[model samples]
Target: MVTHINLKRCIGCQFCVQVCPRGCFEYDFEINKVKLVNPILCLKCRACELNCEGDAIRIEKPIFQNFFAQLI
Candidate 1:
């Protein structure tokens, strides 16, 4: 799941908005920044975090999920 987005570091580039497969992010023209609109829909794929040039996105997986992922 996505846990945080530091607006101060976000460059309004919309990379996360474009890369999110679940449409969890949106570009807010009023603020010229990206917003996490549907965090519940996040798939924890890290696509948003990896694509964010500003490194403003953070995703946290459950401990069990991390352990299972390591096994795979």
Candidate 2:
């Protein structure tokens, strides 16, 4: 799973880049944008999503188990 940054929404504030513990983001100077650098190391803590003012970032996570089956 990885986080996706919507370039259109991102304001290039670099808040997400700075808050990530795994160093998953990098700033592209030429385009004035943010890029996902290392995705595998992402802890999925949702820090970036919460911090993003423009709602540019989304953390995608797969369902670990079926809820109905587990309940049964």
Candidate 3:
């Protein structure tokens, strides 16, 4: 799941908004920034984090999930 978006680091490139599969992010035209609007719909795919050119998106996965993923 997405934990945060550092507004200071965000470049408003809309990469996160464009790459999110679940539509968890939206471009806020008023602010010219990306907003995390549907966080509950996030699939923990890391698409937003990977696509963010500004390195603004942060995803928080559980410790156990990380442990299990390393084993796979």
Task: Give residue 40's lDDT in candidate 3 (0 to 100).
Answer: 70
Model 3 residue 36 CA deviation (Å) reads 0.4
TM-scores for candidates 1 onward, in order: 0.78, 0.79, 0.78
Q: In candidate 3, what are the lDDT values of residues 1-72, reduced to their tens digit? A: 335899989899998878888898888898888888987777778988888899998887555544443234
What is the alpha-carbon lDDT of model 1 when measured against the actual structure? 0.81
> Quick one: RMSD of model 3?
5.3
lDDT of each: 0.81, 0.83, 0.81
Pairs clashing within candidate 1: none
Candidate 2: residue 59 Cα off by (Å): 0.8
**Model 1 misplacement above 4 A:** 61-72
Instruction: Name every residue pair that clashes in candidate 3.
Output: none
lDDT of 1 by residue, 33-53 (tens): 998888777777887888888
| Cα deviation of 13, candidate 3, in Å | 0.7
